[model samples]
Target: MTHLPEPPAAPAAGQARIDDQAAKLLAAVEEAMRTPTSYRDDSPLPDYGPTPPVQQPGAPAMSQQATDVGRAAMFCGLATVPPGLIAIGILVASEHADPTVIGMICAAPAALAVPILAIARLLRSAKPEPEVHQHFHGNVTQTTTHSRTSGVWAKNINQK
Candidate 1:
């Protein structure tokens, strides 16, 4: 065939080839990348590792700390209501008792509420939070399909 026209000369030094060989190689690389050539779905990647254990504050877990904080707030709220009522009850019940003594009793509960709430907050501060992990996945599918009759019913509701 006359030497096949000298093979049409090679690419000039470093020019990217525009031929069947280059196209095939490029296609192979693209396919390999798209299909995840390293690990299968069941296998873990090189970087895959176990999550670290969490530590809570003051030896309390996240759930327990939150509960303590809630209890503290509840007690504080109870302290407020009772103190107000006690002040009113003291004033209305007797003029013989010293107002200061009654006031002290009412204020005592509120004062106690403060330490409980403070301890709750301290416990709450000791709880641990989860670390976030990020990963990239292609072509996530999130579709829900219903039967044609179901779709028609929805459409009818919308029209109404």
Candidate 2:
């Protein structure tokens, strides 16, 4: 087998200069590591004050109250579906029920529940009652009450 040629030798002056610079850089790095430098907080430091609020441009504009009402309506509408299907199934399985009657029975409750829940949510979120304060003359008694609407007829009063 033929022998491979010997590798080329490094140049004397340039190689020595590169090695000298590398050793100097390594020694500078080691000295820097041995004695650490202290950092100073310079001009325009961070303020500890509360940050300004950022408004997103593409965010939806729906109000929380409207979202809550819509969510309630959606849940009620979904809840009514299973019951409506069951009612339809029962009607269809019966011997003498007409197709139109079965359809109506299934459709009515599902159709009504959404609006009913929406109305209930609207009524629930209606403005709180006017504050009532009563003062006594002699004993200096004071009472404050808030009225909460529980249902169509009844209201529960809370005292503070």
lDDT comparing candidate 1 with the true structure: 0.70
Model 1 error, position 65 (Å): 25
Number of the predicted model whose TM-score against the real structure is largest? 2
Reference-based lDDT, residue 55, model 2: 57
lDDT of 1 by residue, 3-103 (tens): 54455466778775678678999999999888764542454445767755545448554587898898999997887786588677867787646767777
**Model 2's TM-score against the true structure:** 0.29
Best by lDDT: 2
lDDT of each: 0.70, 0.75
Model 2 over residues 101-130: C-alpha lDDT tens digits? 877876886698899999998997897967
Per-prediction TM-score: 0.25, 0.29
Window of ten residues with lowest summed lDDT in model 2: 36-45
